[model samples]
Target: MIKFELKDLEVFYGDFQALKGIDMKIPANEITAFIGPSGCGKTTFLKCLNRMNDLVEGCRVYGQVTLDGEDIYNDYDVNLLRKRVGMVFQKPLPFKMSIYDNIAFGPRTHGIRSKSALDEIVEQSLTQATLWDEVKDRLNMDALSFSGGQQQRICIARALAVRPEVLLMDEPTSALDPISTGKIEEVVMELKKKYSIVIVTHNMQQAVRISDKTAFFLLGEVIEFGDTEKLFSVPKDKRTEEYITGRFG
Candidate 1:
């Protein structure tokens, strides 16, 4: 099933065009990776899925982006859209609060007030992110006290608390060490059972390892998009082949 469809999408920051007429369908219940070099608009395109680009000053978007058959830009409430599409950034960004509070924050914002309800959400979210067993006894501890990888998993649990249908990750493993990155990659592959995911990554190996679908972008355009193995093994576009072979980025 197609969870999101972008039709002739274009984005601009002042006079610079960031995304140029992009059109693609993001599948449901799978991980779709956006891969490209720095400044290639892969990150810019990821931001468009949840309208995160709106935070940028002087930024403008043109074209239609639909979520679950509804026009996200036209019919959906920005706040509601965000609730359905949660994001995790490159670095761990937990709130300066207890681990329990960090996971409960999203549910609280969505009007879940009961203490028992919040507790259940926190536990469930953390378990889903595969961090509950490790941090189960430390619910009251400060979130920042954990290592970088643990903190990133905390952020994932926080996003899961909102009951989001889609997860937008921007280089989620970029800041972690090899062990932590492996943990995060495992978690991401496990997450697609219930939620659709879109990830922006410079790590081509990571993309191939976890993503079912791959989209390669260059200079604000998608050069190739298809199944991960096919795209990497037998790219039709010269640019994609070159990029995959490490000849040029």
Candidate 2:
């Protein structure tokens, strides 16, 4: 099943085109990583998946992007669509509320009122995020009290609480230590069974380690895309080989 389809997708910040007629199909319950050098529109293309770029002034998108075979850009509620397609940023931005409240915020806003129901959802989300045992007894504490990695996991739990079908992560492990990065990689691997994950990462090693499919982007164009093993070991594109072998970024 195709979870997302981008057809002739182009994005612009005013007159400057960031993406140039890109097309791709994201499969259901798998992890797809976007990798490229800086300013290559990897993040720009990721933002269009959930319409996150619309918040930027004068940013416009031209092309068809569909989620679950539905045109997300046409006659659809952005708020509801976001709930179905959750996003995690480069940094973890937890609410000022307690740890439990942080995870419960989305469910509450989406009309889950009962305490028992919220508790169940919170537990499930935290477990899925791989932060349950670490903070299980301290649910009422401040989210700020945790370390950077823990905070990121809390943010992931918050995204999961809403039961999103697609999870979009932009450099999710960029700021954490190696151990934290490993933990996140483990959680991401686990998440692919239940949710389709699309990630943008500059860390080629992490991308190779975690993703089943990889898309190589260069200068706002998709240079190549294939299974992780084939793309990393025997790239069809010379540019991909050069980028992967550190000959040139």
Candidate 3:
């Protein structure tokens, strides 16, 4: 099942073209990793999925980007689209409020006012992100007080709280320690059972470990995209092989 389909996608930040002719079908209930060097269109492409790039001034997108057969950029309600597709950033940006409030924020914004319902969402979201056990009793504590890794998981939980069908993670564990990275990887893997996950990662090994499919982007184009194992072990494109072998970015 295809969760997202992009055809002839191009993104321009004023006169500078950030992405050119991107075409890909992201599968449902799987982790798809976009791997490339800095300045490649990986993050730009990720942002397009949920129309996050629309927030940028002078950023224009031309082409078709559909989510579950609906045009996300054509007459779609941007706020609702965002609720259906959540995003987590590179850094752990927990709100200054309590942990419970952070998780309940989205639901509250969506008009879920029942205290019991909000409590359930907070617990379930945290559990899904694999942080419930550690912070179940600390729900009222300030979310910023946690360690970096825990903070990242809290961010993930906050994204999940809205009951999003798709989750976009941008280098979600890049700032964490190895142990925290491993924990986030495990949580992401588990999430694929219920959510279609798209991640932009500079860490190729992390991509290999968590993603089912990998898209290798270079110079604003996808050089290769296929099964994670096949793409890494036997790349069809020479540029992909070189990038994977550390010959060049």
Candidate number with greatest lDDT: 3
lDDT of each: 0.94, 0.94, 0.96
- Those runs of model 1 whose alpha carbons end farther than 4 Å from true positions after fitting are none
Evaluated at residue 58, the lDDT of candidate 2 is 91
State the TM-score for model 1.
0.99
lDDT of 3 by residue, 34-85 (tens): 9999999999999998889989999999999999999999999999999999
Q: After superposition, how far is residue 189 of candidate 2 from its true place, in Å?
A: 0.3
* Candidate 2 regions with alpha-carbon error over 4 angstroms: none
Write one digit per residue (lDDT tens) for candidate 1, span 143-214. 999999999999999999999999999999999999999999999999999999999998999999999999
Name the better of 2 and 3 by TM-score.
3
* RMSD of model 1 against the true structure: 0.7
TM-scores, all models, native as reference: 0.99, 0.99, 0.99
Winner on lDDT between 2 and 3 is 3
Per-prediction CA RMSD (Å): 0.7, 0.7, 0.6
Write candidate 2's Cα lDDT for 74-140 as tens digits.
9989989999999999998899989999999999989999999999999999999899999999999
